[model samples]
Target: MTRIDLHAHAFSAHTAPKVIATLLTLAHRACPGFAPHGDGTLPDLLRAEAAAGFDRVAVCNIATRPEHHAYMARFLTALRSGAMGEEAARRVIPCVSLHPHDPDAAAHLKTLVALGARMVKLHPYSQNIPLDDPATIRLLALIRDAGLPVLCHTGHDVTAGEDDFAGPRRVVNVLDRVPGLRLICAHCAAWRHPETLDLLLGRPVGVDLAFQPATGVEPIIQRFALEHPLEHLYFGSDWPWASPAEHAARIASWGLPQDRQDALFGANAARLLALP
Candidate 1:
């Protein structure tokens, strides 16, 4: 089976070591007993994915602040240019980040796309911006115009408490403003927000199974999979934060039909990403 992880994160060579360390520290502080499968470096992420049996992995980079935008563009450009070694580059898909506060956000996005970025990742909670804010709407429009899909960090973050920046209600509002947007709601349709599933049921949106546990959410996810169009679903590990093999195993345990499992594992992502 061609397993493609639609969501993951890794730091490029250009990323500051301090930034990587800070993120890792924050991750550990947020989730007690959290042990990252790999360090936040690109090479480590590639090896981790390979060890987890992933054929392809998409790295979703998030620029929490405006200053990180340029760095993100350069990093993705280098990755796409195969500057990070060919084998690892071939197995990785780069998703650039966009921040609403950046004055040149649209231009930066255009440059990143020209440099071979096929998708964008948004983290409203980390960016400290509301999804439906005016600037965010404009950014979403620009992303759609650039012909790229966006995988947004929806629902609550483990570290950030009670922030609904990318919650289901806000995402629904965003859809209302931007017609025909190709958005993927990360974290199994907004973790604790099952209502998001119904809200986005018939829309042109994709939901990734990232950071979702099988014990409590598997039954809900399975029910949604059966009730909704399966093509709208995609498999994601949220690597470093979760185990790809474990999540894959959870999906396998769902008892879905072979075709549906295949779709969830890769087909749906391939179609959405226009991957050959």
Candidate 2:
């Protein structure tokens, strides 16, 4: 298996502005003794990936505001094209994002494809767009046509737990409406939600293993990671909010069969990314 981490994030000084700082603060408040394992930088992410024993890591970044898209797209292009640096070129798989409400959404998608982007990320919580909104459906269809897998932020988030805008109910609705989408719902398809676990088990969408231990979701993570079919699961550290090494260690201790472990660690994601 390729040992690829399907979800993680890195940011340059230019990208870690006020919005990024606010998110970090909220994560700390949500998880006790919380502090990032890696600094918010590409080099730090590479170091973390190495520590986690990941052979390759997909670097996903977001731009909630349209004004930031140009800057973010330039950064993503550098990463996907392997222009960031030698280390990143060796191990990083770049993914891009587009705010669903961006008036120029089509143009942004075209730009990402032309830039050789391998995947996409969307956060309905931070981006304030409902999963079933007309705009989001249209964009998701375009991404499916482009053959880009999407990592969508789903379930209750620390920043706005009360906001059910990205809840699993809505996610499943979108899944039903937008057939054939290579969509990976983030945060273990949100086990905290009542219908989420059952819905996730029934749905065809991919689920990323991004369980946060500090949030008292360890048992839930154990159940989901162990029970979910190999082909439907992918490893996601949700790094910066959690540690990649800790999450990887937790799964390793499960004593799963080699092939199952391999599938959870990377094979499924490699197939989704179409890596040879």
Ten-residue segment with the worst summed lDDT in candidate 2?
Answer: 27-36
TM-score, cand. 1 = 0.89
Task: Give a tens-digit lDDT track for model 1, residues 200-226.
Answer: 656666778776452245665666555
Question: What are the per-residue Cα lDDT tens digits for candidate 2 across 1-276?
Answer: 578888888877576555457776886665555556666777877888898789899887876876656866787667656688878877888688887777887787888778778899988877777877888898898889888999988877777656677777888888887899999988865635756767776457778878666666666566667777778788899776667888888888987778778887988988888876
Error of 1 at 186 (Å): 0.4
User: What TM-score, to 2 decimals, does candidate 2 have?
Assistant: 0.92
lDDT of each: 0.78, 0.78
Looking at model 2, residue 22 earns an lDDT score of 76
Candidate 2, lDDT over the whole model: 0.78
> Best candidate, TM-score-wise?
2
